[model samples]
Each structure stands twice: as C-alpha cells, then as structure tokens.
Target: MRKRALDTVFALAQQDERVVYIGSDVGQGTLQGFQESIPERFFVEAISEAYVIGMAAGMAMTGFVPYVNTIATFLTRRCLDQIAVDLCIGNHPVRLVANGGGLVYAPLGPTHEAIEDIALMRCLPNMTVLVPCDAEEMERAVRASLDWSGPIYIRIARGGESVVSLPERGFFIGKAIEVRQGEKLLIATTGVMLQTALEVQDIMARAGYNLGIVHFHTVKPLDTAWLANQLGPYSHVASLEEHSVIGGLGSALAEWLCENGDHKLKRFGIPDRFADRFGNQAKLLSYFGLDAASIAKELQAWVKPS
Candidate 1:
C-alpha cells in the first residue's frame, strides 16, 4: 500500500505540474522515481516533520499541491501544531501521505505505533482523515485527492493487505463502501480491518448469524446519510478498526449514533493503553483481540452465535 500511494504521487506529478513530492527522513530510495523524474519538484528533508508541514503549506499557497510522506506518528504527533496552524487553518491542498499507520511498525514498539493518529487528524477543522482499506483503495484515494479542498490526511496501512474493495463500487472521498448487506448485524470497518471484518462475518455465519460490512475508508466526514440508512434493518451495529478505540472510527460512530439512533454499538479496536509488547503486525493484532477469531469470540458474547 505504501508503494502504491507513493507511486501514485509520482503518477499525479507526471500529469499535473502543480504536484510536488516531499519526503522526511524516509530514506534515499523513497520516491526515487519521482526525485529522478522531477528533481526540481522533489524534496527529501531531514527529521523535521513540523518544517515539512510549514513547507507544504507555503507550497500550497503558491498553487502547488505538496504531498508529504513520513511515518504516521511523526506526521500527526510531532507536527500536530504545525498541521493545525499551517495546513488546516489555511485549508491548503497539501496531502499528508502517512505510512505505517496503526501499528504497522509494531516491532518498533509503542513509540512507532500510530494508535491515536486518527483522533489527532480527525480533530482538526479542515483536515480530512482518510484510511484506505488496501493498495487499490490507496491508489484511488490518491487520485481522488488531487482536487479535494483543504488538508487531507491519507493513512497508509502495511503492504500485501487483502483486496476487498472493487472498482465497481467506485471511490469517493466522503462516501463509505457497502461490502455486504445483512439482516442481523452490521460491521463497519476502516483501513485494514475490512478483511478481518469479512473473516469475522464468515465466522458468525457458520454459527447461524448473518453479518454485513460497511467499509469506512473516510473517517472524518462520516457517511451519515448512507450509514443512517444501512443501520435500520440490522439488530446490532459495530465498528472495527486497527486504531485506538478512542477518537477513531469507533468514537466517530458513537458521536453520530448517540444522537440520531438507538442502536448500541460494539467497538472492536486497540484499547486506550500504550502497546508494551514487541512482535510483527499479526502478533500484535492477535494479542489485542483484533484478529478474526478473537473478534468473533467477543461478538458472540453480545449476540448468541447459534
């Protein structure tokens, strides 16, 4: 997904002269093609994340769409003030292409995890938080991001994710995708959780419970209209994400559902604590009860399997 996103930035630059690439300590080979092809527009800076946001803001003001690439934690945690002041305040068209979102760097410990990044990016007034489900969706988001107004935060997941999204459903910045429809339960997921939701859906199916899925790639502009309509038939609704339970897709749904509906939402995500263990992404996911088996077990506690 990271490759697809960065490669798409170069593809966009090829078509639009206004597009520029900015990398922050992402190694020399990062976006190498873009740097070689458009050396004048490519910039590889040091570990100055705040400076990157300010630079992108300035470039945006000059009518250039600057796409900044870096780790998710640094992009949000280290540069929140700059992002809010320089990008969100001015409503620049700078694209924050964040890599290793939501624990992709779990082997590196909590410091590398972007568990709270969604909340940080979502709080900004003009910042649009987008978490694509896979590489294809990431590519689509990149292309769709070319014209969207305001600062956009594109969350990139680990590579080699499942392909649950389809071109037929189409890609829109604010619209959610309906992966499947069910009668008993509806599982709303964002980013890499779509595939896990699908696995859980099938798990519940074997136990005689029907489950539906709504892929919420866009978290900021919650697709309330479509989501509101989709929840009517299901007896249960839930949100599954790879981010922290707070201030992410789960919290966003709670804020909207609390006022508008009576459905009790079951949120499945990382708890409100920092990660202390070290392992691969899959190990961390299993340890956090985000794997399909564990998620299904939790779901069964609420709704009887059979």
Candidate 2:
C-alpha cells in the first residue's frame, strides 16, 4: 500500500509540475524512488513535523501541491495546530500522507498508535479524511488528491495489503462502495479493517449468516444517504474500524443512524482505555476483539435470533 501511494504520487509529479513531496525525517527505502525522480521537489524536514507542515503550507501558498509523509501520530497529534490552522484553515493544497494509522505500529506502544487521528482531523472545516482499504484505493486517492484544491488526510495501512482491484473511476470522495450483498446484517468498515470484514463475510456466509459489506473509505463528509438506504433493510448493522470507538467510524455511523432514525447497530473497534501491552499488530487487534474470530463471535451473540 505504501509503495502504491508513493508510486502514484511520483507519477502525478511527472505530469503536474505543481506537485511536491516532503517528509519529516522519513528516509525509508520506499521513498527513495520519489527522491531519485524528483530530488528538487522532495525535502526532509529533519524530524520537525510542525516545520514540515509550515513548509508544505508555504509551498502551497506559492501554488505547489505539497504532500507530507510521516508517522501518523507525529503528523497529526504533534503538528495538529499547524495542520488545523496553517493548512486546513488556510485551505491549502497540502496532502497529509500518514502511514501506520490506527495502531499498525502497535509494537511501538501508545506513542505510535493513531487510534484517534481520523476523529481529530475530521474536526477541521476543510479537511478531507480518506482511509483507503487497500493499495488500489490508495493509488486512486493519490490521483484524486493531485487536483484537489484543499487540505486532505490520506490514512494508509503499514504494508502488505491485498489488492482491492476497484476501477479508478469507481472511487469517489463522498460515495460508499458496496463490496458484498447480504440480507440480515450490514458491515460498514473503514481502512484495513475493510479487508477483515470481507474475510468475516465469507466466514459468516459458510455459517449461514448473510452479511453485506460496505467499505466507508472516506470518514469525513460521510456518505450518509447511501449508507442509510443500504442499512434500511438489515435488522442489525455493524460498524468496524482500526481506530477508537469514540468519535471514530462507529460514532459517526451511530450519529448518522440516529439522526436518520436507523437503529439496532453494533460497534466493533478499539476500546476507550489505552492499550498498555506491547505486541505486534495481530496481537493488538486480537486483544481488542478486532480479529475475525472475535468479531464473528461478537456478531453471533448480538445478532442471534430474537
């Protein structure tokens, strides 16, 4: 997914001279290609995340579309004031490419976890939050962001994600993509958890539980009308994400459903408490009941015949 995003941005820079890439001490081998291709446009801010945003904002002020890549926590949590005021309030064409979203860097402890990034960024007036489900979606998002005129947040999983294989034209900012068709339950997922929802849908199908999957890749300015229509028939609905249950996708969906009178929903995500244990991504996901087995168990208990 990271490679796809980098390659897409590099390709966009080839055609649009307005595009630039800036990093906050990010010298990964994956970024080497962009540095080689557009050395004049790529920059390293030497660990100053706030300066990175300031520089990106300065570039945007001069009509350059700057894309800043960094760890999720540092990019948003550390430099939030710059993001909210400099980029968002200014409505600059600065694309925030944040990797390791939603505890993908769980092994590094809470400091590295970005469980509330979406909620934090979504509060800004002009910020557009995008959580691509896979590499293909990330590529599409990159292409779209090149021409986008305002600030945008692109949250990507760490690495090693399956190909979503959706058409380029099919990707839209305010539309939800229906991945599967089922009868009893609707699975609304964002980020890499959308893949998990697909796996769970297959498992539930074999177990005779019909499930519908809706990939809500865009968290901000959610596609509520589309979601409400799809969720109208299901007796039970599930909202899933890799972020916190508070003010994240679960809360967004719940608020939308309540405002629209769509109820009987289940929320699956990280709890409010800080995760004290240090472990790998899979372990952390399992510990939070975000693993497929645990999610299935929870759904069975909640959706049992009543």
Candidate 3:
C-alpha cells in the first residue's frame, strides 16, 4: 500500500509541476525512479521530522503541493507543533503519507506503533483524515489528495492487504461506501478493519444473521449525510478500526449518533492502553480481540438476545 501510494504520487508529479516529494530518512532506493526523473522536486532528508514538516510547509507556501512521507508515529507525535501551526493553522495543501499506521510496526514495539494517530490527526482543525483499506484504495486516496484544498493525513497499513473495495462502487473523498446491504446490524469500519468486517459479515450470514458493512475511508470529513440516512434503518450499529477506540472512526460515529439520532453502538478497537508486548500485527490484533473470529464472536453476543 505504501509503495502504491508513493508510486501514484510519482505518477502525479510527472504531469503536475507543483507536485513535490519529501521523505524523512526512508529506506534506500525508495522512489529512486521519481528522484531520478524529478531530481529538483525529490528530497530524502535525515531523521529530522519536525524540520521536514516545516520544509513542506514552506514549499506549500510557495504554491507547491508537497507530499511528506515518514513513520506515522514520528509524523504525529514528533511534529505535532509544526503540523498544528504550519499546516492546520493555514490549511496548507500538504499530503502526509504516513506509513506504519496502527500496529503495522508491532514487531518494533510500542515506540514504533501508531495506535493513537487517528485521534491525534482527527482533532486538528482543517485536517482531513483518511484510512484506505488496500493498495487499490490507497491509489485512489493518493489521486484524490492532489486536488484537496487542505492538509490530508492518510493512514495506510503495510503492503499485501486484501482488496475489499470494488471499482464499480467508485471512490470519493468523504463518502462512505456500503460494501454489503442487510438489516438489523450495521458494521462501520475504517482502515484495514474493513477486511475483517467483511469476513465477519460472511460468518454472521452463515449463522443466519444479516450483517451490513460500510467502509468509511475518510474519517474527519465523514459522510454524515449517508451515515445519517443509513443509521436510521439499522437496529444495532458497530464501529471497527485498528486505532484506539477513542477519537477514531468509532468515536466519530458515536458523536454523530449522540447528536443526530439514537442507536445501539458498539465500538471495537484498541482499548485505552498501550500495546506493551512485542509481536507482529496479527498477534497484536488477536491480543486485542480484533481478529475476524473474535469480532464475529463478539458481534454474535451483541446481536443475539438474552
């Protein structure tokens, strides 16, 4: 997914002179073709994340659309002040290509994980938060960022995610796509959790429960109109994400339900705690009861009557 997004940025740079690529000490030979093609517009700086954001802000001030790539934890935790002051304050057209969102860096421990990135980015004013499900959707998200008016924080998982998003459904920023249609239960998801939600949908279907899954690719400027319309038809609604249960897609939906309507909502995500153990992404998800089997079991308990 990361490679696909950067490749899309490179493709866009070929056509648009305003496109610039900046990386904060990423792996060697990353986007080598882009650097060779557009030497003047490509930069691979040291581990100075704050300085890199400031540079991107300056480039944006000069009417250049800069795409900054770095670890998600560094982008959100290390450069909060620069992002808040330089990007959000002025609403710059800087695209933050954050890698290792959620527990993608689980083997590297909590220091590298970005479990709270969504909460951090979504709270900033004028910041658009996106979490594409797979490589194909990441391409669409990258393409959409080219014309976006303000700063965009796109959270992507490691490569090799399943393609749950269909081309026929189309891609639109701030629009929710309903992948499955059913009554009584609504499973709203963001990021790679859509894949788990789809699996849970099938599991519930086999067990005689109809489940609907909605992919919320854009979280900040949420598709409230579509959500509002969809919320009215379902008796139980659940939100799933790889992020913390607070201030993420689930929290956003909870807030909207609080104001606009009344519905039963169960938010499935990382609880309010740090993942101190060292393991891969699958282990962390399983530990947090976010795996497809665990999610299906929880949903069965929630949807079934006492």
- The superposed Cα distance between candidate 2 and the true structure at residue 28, in angstroms, equals 4.5
Error of 3 at 98 (Å): 0.4
- Judged by TM-score relative to the true structure, which candidate is superior, 2 or 3? 3
lDDT of 2: 0.86
Worst 10 residues of 1 by lDDT: 297-306
Better of 1 and 2 by lDDT: 1
C-alpha RMSD values across all candidates: 1.0, 1.6, 1.2
Q: Residues 151-196, candidate 3, lDDT per residue (tens digit)?
A: 9999879789888788787789999999888888999999999999
> Residue-wise lDDT of candidate 2 within 36-122, one digit each (tens)?
878999887798898899999999999999989989999989999999889988899999999899878887899999998988998
Residue runs of model 1 more than 4 Å from their true location after superposition: none
Give the 10-residue window scoring lowest on summed lDDT in candidate 3: 297-306
Question: What local lDDT score does residue 113 receive in model 2, on the 0 to 100 scale?
Answer: 94
What's model 3's overall lDDT? 0.92
- Could you tell me every candidate's TM-score relative to the true structure? 0.98, 0.95, 0.98
lDDT of 1 by residue, 133-154 (tens): 9999999999999999899999
Q: Residue 79 of candidate 1: its Cα lDDT?
A: 94
Q: How many pairs of residues collide in model 2?
A: 0
269 Cα displacement, candidate 3 (Å)? 0.3
